[model samples]
Target: MSRKFKKVVEYTFLILLACIFIFPLIWMVASSMKPEANIPVDMGSIQSLLPSIVPSEWFQTYQELFSRFDVFQYIFNSVTYAIVVTLGSIVVNAMAGYAFSKFDFIGKKVLFGLLIALLIVPAETLIITQFTVAHDLGILNTRLAVILPMIANMFFIYLFRNFFKAIPDEIIESVKLDGANYWTIFWKIILPMSKPAIATVGTLSFILSWNDYLWPLMVLTDSEKFPLQVAITNINTTPPVYTNQVMAILTISTIPLIIVYIVAQKYLLQGLGGSGTGIK
Candidate 1:
């Protein structure tokens, strides 16, 4: 095939793939609205998906779910945890990444080398170790138990390290020459220029932290402190299977993250290729 023809085919294939991925999301919304029988169908009940089409008890289902459990509180807890983790991880990882990318010091290379190695270790492998620490700290049921472990991400630091390293040394030198110190260069110059990379790490961290069930489940025993993901899990029961309720809870759980990505999409996109701007 000609180069232009191949490029067109590639883009066409990608669009189809995108539709394939997005179809499930569309179907989820559709399934959430349908009467119970319609859910098991391939396309779902078509009428329920229409915004104006209302099931008789449509509003009541949402109200019933919320009233039965403090779903709002769960949503709040999840949002709070996700936000705190995102900000903390971003700060710690960005600083670590900047240092690893810029500074030369004793053990720097070794430490970074070890960090990279740690990324290969599955988080599940350290559950016992983490549990022990949580037990010793007496914070097993607290939000802190879930929050503290994930702050300094090895992968994010490494990502920023590589991205920051691509920044020209002359920018740092120029900042230094202007009587600005290391902190100033990092805060004022480097960070603003690295929005895309920062957003990349932040977005991933938020998604993982928000959707996380096993780690949070292990740590938080209190229902009040449970994130939406945890709360959703609790709603599942064996009989009469409230599938609509389950999907409603899931749909609620998914909304804020969707809004976040929609809002931050530009920055997220920029972050992937990283930036090539002069920091100074």
Candidate 2:
């Protein structure tokens, strides 16, 4: 085959793959704009990917959702919690990573080894222990219960450590010679250069916190404190379940995550590709 034909085939294959992955999102947004009765009728056909032509039903599900349910409160709670945890995790994990990469403290090797070991342990196994600790701290049913447990992740620490390791030692030494302390070097010098890593961690952290459902459900009994994911379940289980409303809520919940990924796409790619140097 000619080179031009091969290129054409490759592009065609890639477009098909992209469409396969994006179909669900299109269907969801389309369904959300449709009436409940129209959803099932359009399913399994190309029409499923298109919104209702009726102007009245276009936003009917959203209107009902806002009027009957405190969806804004749930969205607010989730966004607040995700932001707090994402920012906190980035700072704490970055600092820990800096220490591990630059400092020569005792037991640093052992501690870092333990941190790496933790990556193999399934997070589900720790839920019971986390619950116990949260109960002991008397933070159950509170925002703190959710935020605190997720703010210091081992994988993010490891990612930051590897990213920091890629920085030259001469940079640290030169900064120190100019009377800059570790904090100055870290905040002003290191962090500014580590945008890719920061974006990677922040994006992942935000998504994790936003999608988290079980822990919030277990800890928070009050509907008022529930996050969007848990609140969606409540909407589903409530009597007179409306499929359109459920689709609308899911569509709403997914938008933030899509926006985050789009904004961070460049940095996320760089960070995942170049952040590591064999875990030294």
Candidate 3:
């Protein structure tokens, strides 16, 4: 085949793959705009997937949603929790990664190995223990309870460690010769250079924390404290089954995370690719 024909084929294949990933999101946005009376009855029809732009049913749905529930409060709670968790995870996980990469200490290998092993363990298995610890500390039903357990994730630590390990030893040694302590090096040199890794971890951490339903549901009893994800669930299970309102809320809940990923996607991809290579 000619080179031009091969390029056309490759582009076609890529577009198809992109469509496969994108169609569901499109469907979701479409569904969110539908009226309760128009849903289920109209589902799977082309009309169901095509949102009415002139009247904009989605806006009406959102208006009803906000009127009924404090949706803004849920959004605020989600943003606050996600940001705190992301920032705290960056500090804690990055520090642990840096220590594992640069420091020589007792049981270092064993500790890192344990951390690696933890990556294979199911997070669901730890819920009871995490709840117990939170209860013991008198933090249950508080924002801290929701935030604390998620701060030190193993995958992020591994990402930072591998990324840090890839930095030249000569650079660290030069900084050390310049009377720099580990903190100085970390704050001034390491973190700034690790932006891609930071972005990767931050984006993932934000998404996980933002979308977390079960933990927040378990810990936060007050409706006022409910994050968007849990709040949306409450909407779903409530009486009369306002499917349109549920869809609208879900659509709103997803927008911020999508915006975040779009903004940081470049760094996220670079960080993951770099970490994968570094680990080998």
Using TM-score as the measure, the top candidate is: 2
Candidate 1 lDDT tens digits, 168-222: 9998998899899889999998898888788888887787788878888889888
lDDT of 3: 0.85
lDDT of 2 by residue, 1-280 (tens): 6999999999999999999999988988898898889988988888889999887889988998888899999999999999999999899999999998889999998988888898777777688998999999999999999899888888788889889999999998998999999999999999998988888898878877998888999999999999999999999999889888988999989899889878877656554532234431
TM-score of 2: 0.86
In model 2, what lDDT does residue 259 have?
96
Provide TM-scores for the models. Answer: 0.79, 0.86, 0.84
Computed on alpha carbons, the lDDT of every model, listed in order, comes to: 0.79, 0.88, 0.85
Ranking by lDDT: 2, 3, 1
> In candidate 3, what are the lDDT values of residues 1-280, reduced to their tens digit?
6999999999999999997998777777776776777777767777777665547565787898899999999999999999999999999999999999999999998998888898888778788998888889999899998999889988888889999999998999999999999999999999999988888898878877887878999999999999998998899998866877887888999899779878987766654532333322
TM-score of 3: 0.84
Q: Candidate 2 or 3, higher TM-score?
A: 2
The model with the greater lDDT, 2 or 3, is: 2
